[model samples]
Target: MLLERILRFFIVLIMAIVGGTLFELAVPTANAYFTAPLWHEEIAVLGLSPAGLLCILCGTALGGMIGYPLAPFVTGWLRRLSLWVEAQLGKMPTRDVIAGAMGLFIGLIIARLLGDAFFTIPIVGDYIPIVFSIVLGYLGVHIMVRKQQELAEVFDFIPRFFRDMPRVREARVAPQAPAAVRDGQTDRQYKLLDTSVIIDGRIADICETGFLEGTLLIPVFVLEELQHIADSADSLKRVRGRRGLDILQKIRKESRMKVEITEADFEEIAEVDSKLLQLAQEVGGKIITNDFNLNKVAQLRGVSVLNINALSNAVKPVAIPGDLMTVQIVRPGKEHGQGLAYLDDGTMIVVDGGYRCMNEVVSVEVTSALQTAAGRMIFAKLTR
Candidate 1:
């Protein structure tokens, strides 16, 4: 409401100024053509002709009246157009947006110069600048967006040029600290937390132990996903989602490490995993997740991934061949005469020829332990 009033005031003020100027310009012509005594008569109070003062007053009043009604419609239209532009920009990558803006500025400058050169041409002269500006501005944006990567490379020299400058004098006076060191301490790495790791709830525990260092970076998109899950119709999904949110809150409040929620998101990327990879690259951070597929994909993309499942497996007690251990077979395996059991930390132990021992604890000799991306599996046979 306040904004609308401000807009209305500006509109009225501008119209009144223009109207007064126009009336002032026209009054001389009127006085010249009419050649009346009334036109020539000056007012004693203000040193102006009575007709000129009256015409200016009427013009200002008319302009104010006209502007008053048009303000609301113009304001509403501008608000909607701004919203649309914001939405469109949000969908584009940051690099592309920057490049497009630069291109638009350059295009407009060129258009202005070219437009002025042809300003002397009759009839079409006035429209030429407008047409040129629209066409060039659009071409600039399109071309820059399509070639944003190449443009980024082109601009890469700016940083390199600065970096290559000699700092021998500064070094002699006072040596600069290394990038990794802050106040004589090593700088911690940024550990970006993914949804799966948050939901799994081990990250908070790990953080509490002070094993994990660096800032716990949580992206806004990951938080949104958690909220969506928390609001899910399914009870299990809702619980998991709520748990993730709770874990995040606890980590933020209790954890010693810096906790930051980044608004950085890749709208161009559809998959959350892909976005996570992109974000990792952007921030030079490692992703913390429990997702096997995500870990593999991230590794393939050369992005560092810290998988909770893999970490769990790494920390578990190593079970080698010929090691004797006792296990309870809770269920039969796919193979005949084989039973399956899980270690305390959820490691799968396949008990061969122990089908009859289902629902019972028995001694078993480990045959082998195979390690995979998901986890570790131990193969064993009944000792009895």
Candidate 2:
């Protein structure tokens, strides 16, 4: 509100000054062209003429009156324009915005140099410089924004300088405690949680086990996605989304570990996985998810990831060939005379020559174990 008033005052002041200047110019023109032949007597007593003085006073008063009323409207329009500009900028990635700004600066510098050269040309000279400036500015921005990632590497020296700088200390000062000791906690690491891990509900159990450390950071976009899914027309999607929200609520209430809902989001990235990667990069954090594709992408981008599925696989009981275990053959497998069974943890067991033992628990000898993208599968034969 205070800023608006200040802006209004400046606008009104400028408009009034312009109006007075116009009146001053008009009075001189009128005197030279229309007033000189009509008046013969002395129109001025002092240095100032009556006609000129009257025009000055009238113009100043009229300008002030007009500006006073129009200021609010002009101020509102400027405020709206500023808000629109900010909204547009917010839609672009931070890297792109920085690249675009640098490009624009370089473009203007080039335009100024070329404008001087073009000024000597005929007919088209007046307009050519402006057109060139606009075109070059746009092209520069487009190219720079597209190559923003590569351009970012050019500034590596900045961080390198700070990293190499030596610390200076006073000789007589008492030593301070380490930051962790002073804060009464270990150095906090952030782990950004994704929608898949949350909905899978294993994360909540993992938190209960007290193995996973660090603060769990959930982005607002992920929550919004969950909400959208919860309100979906498909019953299965709605149920899964509701379960995810429930799991989140349970984690918040039951777990002693820190869980935070973050408002940080990248509007420029359309996909949630891409935004998660960007967020992890910005926060210097690891992403905790069960999404295989996300895990691969994060790994390729050099971002740290904690895959729940991977953790589960790593901790599953190791079964070797020739080891005997009991499994219930629930159904038949694709191979002839094969039976499929499942362990308590949902590991698939393919039993050979056990098709007749369907719906029965029997001892099986492990033949081999294979790990796939989905999970681990064990091939076994019924023990005699």
Candidate 3:
């Protein structure tokens, strides 16, 4: 309310000044043309004619009355505009904002240079620069923002001293090796985490063990998907999603590697998995996931994938034929006279001729072990 009043006061003051200036200028002209006594009649108190003073007062009053009603509308419009701009700016990343500002500055400079050349042109001369400024500014912002990544890449080729030069093409080296490699440094690749890996909650343990290296990147889209799942109506999905968020927090707090949440997104790609693949390809990073299908797809696309399930299987203790092991026959197996047991690590142990030993812990000798896509299985028989 106070802000509105302040805006109203400024509006009224400006309008009154305009109205009074118009009236004052007209008074002398009126006296010069009419020779009226009222127009020339000076007031002893103020040293101004009654007609001029009265006109100025009426102009001020008219201006105030007009401004009084318009203040609310003007203030509300300005408030809304400011809010809209703030929202837009909030959504844009810092890099994009900087690029857009630079683009706008360059566009305005170009417009100013071109505008002077056409200033002498007839009727449309005044409007030509304004049109150029608008069109060029929009084009500049669009081009700069859309090609910001490419622009960054191009700038990388230029030497530090020559970076400030206007002629960038002359100073740039030929595109051969990446900037990092050319400078004799190996850039650490990002390890992007997907929703499935986070939900599985084993990746946190892996990070804690110091096995995974490089920065751990979590894209905003993946986070949004987690949020959606967390808010889901299904109790199981909500729990899983919440667990994923918790795991991410734990990883951030306890993991040795750096964790980053990126705002990068692909609007055209609808699937999160596809986006992850595309992101990995673009950033030259690898995807760390427990999703089998995603792992296969990423492999097909030539994008590197670090499968958590694969790693778990690889690290499992190996069993060989003739190896003696103890097991508890929890239940009968599908085959006749076969009993099923499980290792502590969840590897299935099939014991032949041990059906009678159900619910009993017995000694068994391993005959063979079969490795399947799912996991490892040990086949053995009961020992006397």
CA lDDT of each candidate?
Answer: 0.82, 0.81, 0.83
Off by over 4 Å in 3: 1-186
- List candidate 2 stretches off by more than 4 Å: 1-187
- lDDT: the better of candidates 2 and 3: 3
144-186 in candidate 3: lDDT tens per residue?
Answer: 8877767866886577446435433422652222333234444
lDDT for each residue of candidate 2 in 1-384, tens digit (9 for 90 to 100): 999889888877787777777887788623433343334224442344567767877787788789988999998899899999999999975656888999988887888788889988999888888987998888888878776655655676678457534322421231232222223443467788889888999998899788988888788889999999999999999999999999998787557578766666677789998988987776667999998889999999999999989899998888899999998999999999999999889999999988999999999999999998899999999997
lDDT of 3: 0.83
lDDT of 1: 0.82
TM per candidate:
0.49, 0.51, 0.52
List pairs with backbone clashes in candidate 3: none
lDDT (10s digit) by residue, model 1, range 1-384: 888789879988888877887887788533333343653543423555667788888888887888778778878898899999999999875667888998999889989999999998999999999999999999888888777656755888788567635554544454322222212333457788999999999998889788887888788889999999999999999999999999997786556677866666677898887888887775678999988888889989999888888778889999989999988999999999999999999999999988998899999999999998768999999998
Candidate 3, 207: how far from true, in Å? Answer: 0.4
Colliding pairs, model 2: none
Between prediction 1 and prediction 3, which has the larger lDDT?
3
